[model samples]
Target: MKTIAILFIAFCSTISFGQTEKESDIVINNSQQDDTYRAGETIHVNAAIQGDLVTAGGKLIINDSIYEDFTAAGGELFLNDYIADDVRVAAGRITVDAEIGDDLVVFAGEVILTENAVVHGNLKCFAGNIEIHGDVMGNLDIKGADILIDGTVKETSKIVGEDITIGSNAKFHKEVQYWSSEGQMDFKDSLVNTEAYFDEDLGEEKSELSLISLGIASFSLWIFYVLSAFLVILVLHALFKNAFSNAVEGLQNNLLKSFGYGLIYLLGIPLLIVLALVVIIGIPIGLFITTIFIFSLLFGHLIAALLLVYYYKQKKEKDWGFWNITFLALGIAIILRLLTIIPFLGILLSVIILSITYGALTLNVIHSKKQFVKT
Candidate 1:
């Protein structure tokens, strides 16, 4: 979880490094870095990363080696290299044809582990469709809609899915436990060294909950959140257009400085508020500060979206009309909300965004006051 949080932070922080031109893709070839961070429309890495590799893009292909942990989120992902540590990926489609020294974790629409793929540690995945034809040296845990495993599992295997198929070539050293509405599946006697357990209760429980209803509810909430964020962005732009622009400009010019100031504000303001609350005479002051902090937290992503759109427009040199800018901001907000669907990642991203947004706003105010004094 800690590693996942770091990856999310890296993903957002590296947005500033994205390509300015649409036709150009971010590529790393035969290079070595302590840590790699990249965000773009398309990213291809052929380098040997000496440290962690974190990336977010439209499509990502890694054909090199990662010496440390690997974390990525994208539309499509292809892994054709070696990871010396754990790997965690979230994508629309994923293909793994590499060797992992540690655990393999994935969240996706479709996942395929080619014959060349090998996981030295456990394999845990959640997806819509999963096909495994590789070798897992440790335990295997999978949850999906359609699952077909023709791989070799050296340890126990646990699976839950709507449709589960174990190919004739599948080999399991330990017990194989599967839960499916179709009930027990026929497996070759020689395939499992131990027992095969069918979990009918799990399927019954799942059916009782009605997955369709749950999905609809969750999707509706997501829509509501996105629309609310869009409305907030429009209101903020309408009321404080100039101030917001200045803050984003300050953020653009001093990203690292803004991050530093943001971190201070995120951590320091709370301490000051707590100190103020300890005094009877300062209770009102503390309450006011608390209210402001709450508002900042509530609209952190909106401000971050504004900054992202502003940077994108500046980089592309596009002249966006008022409504166009708002629409762009809305799009960014939607993307941010989607990213938050990943567990643990959302909290970390929220913190980073809140810090940066408030930091930029504070800087803009300071700069404005200084200018007023000069005048």
Candidate 2:
């Protein structure tokens, strides 16, 4: 019986990933043409994507062609295909190939541009270490701990790092602007115009100014979001407390499944809308349905998050404290919002995780209500 229960849960987990028309859980490979995705225990992409590709998992590999842009936020992202447009990626490790028509912006722990890779535009990166051996038609703007460039940059280059290396084969057309941690500047290679900035007075002054500006902006945004969220939660605290608590619980219990759901919806809705155009009446319906799905998914995630917090309280055998839940819930909400900015897959995965958490919590509530009626 225990094994059966475990197997049943596992089966639900598997089915949850491949669902197309389901609500509250992850939906994978939902529609037809131009977009293809499979969200299961993990996400595997082995097909062509005419549009953008978004996925979330421990590892994501795109060994196929992407006609449009590709954005991913996850642990490890490997793209060994042809992407016609820009590639914006945020991950732990990012490897890119194929041809990109526009600029490539990446934020990761480690970034690599292999030999066969080609980019028609600029390559900007923020990572711990970046190694480029590919061909970039424009400048390479890199900010990281260590940067190694063995590729071709058709335009100027600006690099800021603790350690910077411009390999022998690496060619930069215009000038080189570098910022380093070492007090002294090293101009090892022959260059037309090479300018180096030290981390002392000049860099320090600029850094202070930039930091102040960033801090102000960040604080303002935070305050606004916090206030808005507080007002909403306060108004509906009684009604939404349970729902919110359940959503958080779901996230804690099944974060990956929630992510899988996001992977499905983020990539599927557009494809469905395109299919809906086959019949004129389907256009409005499709749009409306997509909007509802997106909203519901977001709401569900919020509810799940709340539930997770409440579950923790129950486990500890402590009284439910509204202030504690409120504070933590708001914090999580803010963090999730920040996660959404991560390229294509990040936003979608966040949505999926939240939706599953929220939906499951809602179901529990409805069931409990029904049970009360029987009593």
Candidate 3:
């Protein structure tokens, strides 16, 4: 427990607020031999974990020595310690200034591997930009907007991004294959034989307006198909009106989690693939997984919406008919899809609506309406 306490203190000292923080606010500190920490806001750690360090926070900073694995979720993270096991994190910005004994997998807005840092195993990263000035003993895989490697990569490396810079001092013991916006990879400085592949779908630039128009057309087609299908399903399931009604209510209440699940599915697939490829013979399975993910994303969203509607109607005190709940959910899903195409504001709106819709639905299905209402 000493190590856990130390970890807790280290994290708490960096946070700006106290216990009076918002409902979403969370803070954790673990200073013990076996660190166990969980939070919803910000976390600072200075502990040694004999077991895994699992956390779900808005921001995380670790400055201790951990003996086990660490998993965290946040908007920003700064890790400046020694981790004996693998590290997995999802944040907006991630800065590493320490040593990792195993793999380092991260998703963030920006990831910086500072000088003197060392990664003993593979490094898989996805972000807006990746700046590496450390040592990687195994392969360094990345996907980002801009990627700069100014240190040593002991083994192989693969990257996909908009811009890449392999510093003069950069050393690669094995092959380094990459893809970028230029349609080809270049070893700007002196280096061993490097292979750069181009994106197979790369083509001459088309007008942005053309793509936007096509997107609209696709949306319209989806709307038509959805409406037709919902009507057919509703008519067939008329006898199960109570059950369908309950599902709808559930969806309305728990829409948030469903939306979050969808977003996770979107960002998690590529990262998982990168990690899997590091293990020998896992490459084929990883690629197949990615293909399945791509094919299921839209279908998953649609199903989530449908499930929500069904729960809502069935759980209501005054039961609703199948058509009532089905139409409402279909309408909401169609609107959400349409809104997702509007750019920045649209994205935010879609998240909000989807979250609400799914959240309500989840609540309806998981618990009695009276019990849920009491909470």
Please give the CA lDDT of all the candidate structures.
0.75, 0.59, 0.61
Candidate 1 per-residue lDDT, tens place, 1-375, comes to: 222323333333223322222325889986777988766557899889999997766678999999999987766799999999999887667999999999998867789999999999999987778999999999999878889999899998888888888887788899887898688878775365588899876666445434332222467655645644554465444434556667777888887888888899889989999999999999998976776666566567777888777777777888886668878999887777666546799778877787787778778767776876799
Q: What is the TM-score of each candidate against the true structure?
A: 0.55, 0.51, 0.51
Winner by lDDT: 1
Error of 3 at 343 (Å): 23
Q: For model 1, state the Cα shift of residue 59 in Å.
A: 1.1
Better of 2 and 3 by lDDT: 3
Per-residue CA lDDT of candidate 2, range 1-375, in tens?
Answer: 122222322322322332222222233333225644322223556666777765544456777677777765555678887887888766567788767878898866788899988889898886778899999898878877777888777787777777777787777667767777764666556353554444444345335433321113467656644544443233223234444444445545556665555455556766887788668989887765555554444343344345556667766777756656756666665666566657897666665555555445444445456656789
Q: Count the backbone clashes (under 3 Å) in each candidate.
A: 0, 20, 56
Model 2 — TM-score against the truth? 0.51
Model 2 steric clash total: 20
Over 4 Å off in model 1, which ranges?
1-23, 204-375
Candidate 3 regions exceeding 4 Å error are 1-30, 188-375
Model 2 segments more than 4 A misplaced? 1-32, 35-41, 183-332, 335-375
lDDT of 1: 0.75
